[model samples]
Target: MIEWFTIVQVSVAVAAGLLCVVLGLAGRKPSDLTMGAAALVEVLLIAQLVIAIASPAFGNEPTGSLLEFYIYLVSAVLLPVAGGFWALIERSRWSTVVLGAVCLAVAVMVYRMNVIWFVQGA
Candidate 1:
């Protein structure tokens, strides 16, 4: 993984996590703005996956279990969507809580993924 890409992803994760937490704490119900932010983060994750996968073809392979990385990639991408769905169904401030939790989880997953990559790739 390129250094800059890793930084960008981590930054995104932090931003998304903080945003969700703030909204949740403010007792705001799920709003389009929150979902839209999640969607944007999801898009970045997808792009990251593509870059990570294709990098190997260009000879920048991560030494970690590509399988493990792929699994994290796929699962992390779904977290936001699942949270959003639950928020819509529950229709309460706690739904924002759920989204906040999801975002934080994704942040942790992103950091883990980066660790796995660097530990093995280095």
Candidate 2:
């Protein structure tokens, strides 16, 4: 994955998480803005996945551990999508909590992705 893109994803996730926290604390449900940000993060993740697949920067063939890569790839994108949908349906402050939880998850996933890449390089 591109370093800049990873950095951007991390930044966005942190921002989204902070927004979610503030909204939740204020008793406001998650807004469209939060959902939009989550969607944008998913898009960035998809781009990162494409870069990983295309470059496989660790130098091993991309196909050898396809399943492992795919698990992270799929979940990283799917979690926010699911969270956003659930948030829309809930229509309560809990929705903001859900969004915050998703942001936390995305942050963890990004870190894990970096770790996997680093370990593979060793």
Candidate 3:
């Protein structure tokens, strides 16, 4: 839970979430731009996962239930892929809405993870 990384991750997640919601409200289906943005956010989540798990090697460990934190992190990582697949399958505005909601969920999960890391410090 590096400070700078967490800040960047939260900022990106929120931005991506807002973008997804906007795209959904605009009635756009899955498109290159939208999917790419989601993918970007997904990559960031995975990167955060890597850093979090490896932090202990660098003498940092989150002072929380590491397993539970991992569950949230993994879910955050999975959401974009799930939402993308669902959007592809449904191919409607509602599908985009689902993606938007997924992104928002990811944002919330990211925040929770931060709390878990900060409040329950290693």
Candidate 4:
């Protein structure tokens, strides 16, 4: 729930998501670039997981419903994985678009999680 880190995650997610979508719309199939973008998003989410785990010890616990925050965090972590798997299995432009869509969805979810942690709880 660190504000700066959350911003970074959202920015990266949006950038990567847009890149994939643009490429897919250009009739590109799922390639390393698209997959790599998805992977990058996953890596950020994993980092977020680690941060969440350790933040409480640092006196940075979420101010909202802990259960709801964790649910969003965990689900956001899974979206890229599922999308990547789908892309790998399909190997089509639409699959690339799907991967991009997943990234965008993750970005939204992460933002919501932040809101739950900092705004909704208040």
The number of the candidate with the highest TM-score is 4
Q: Give model 3's TM-score versus the native structure.
A: 0.91
**What count of clashes does model 3 give?**
2
| Better candidate by lDDT, 1 or 4 | 4
Which has the greatest lDDT? 4
User: What TM-score, over all chains together, does every model reach?
Assistant: 0.89, 0.83, 0.91, 0.97
Q: Tens-digit lDDT track for model 1 on 76-100?
A: 9899889888988997878887787
- lDDT of model number 3: 0.82
The alpha-carbon deviation from the true structure for residue 32 of candidate 4, after best TM-score superposition, in angstroms, is: 0.6
Question: How close to the true structure is residue 42 of candidate 2, measured as C-alpha lDDT?
Answer: 80
Local accuracy of candidate 3 as per-residue lDDT tens digits, 3-113 = 778778778777777887788889888777777777888998988988997988998777788888899999889999999899889888777777777877887888888
Between candidates 1 and 2, the one scoring higher on lDDT is: 1
**Which candidate, 1 or 3, would have the higher lDDT against the true structure?**
3
lDDT of 3 at 115: 82
Q: Which ten residues in a row have the lowest lDDT in candidate 1?
A: 113-122
Q: Which lDDT value does model 1 have at 41?
A: 73
- Which residue pairs in candidate 3 have backbone atoms (N, alpha carbon, C) closer than 3 angstroms, thus clashing? 63-121, 63-122
Q: Comparing 1 and 2 by TM-score, which wins?
A: 1
Q: Write the per-residue lDDT of candidate 4 for residues 1-122, one digit (tens) a residue.
A: 68999999999999999999999999999999999999999999999999999989999878888898999999999999999999999999999999899999999999998898788854
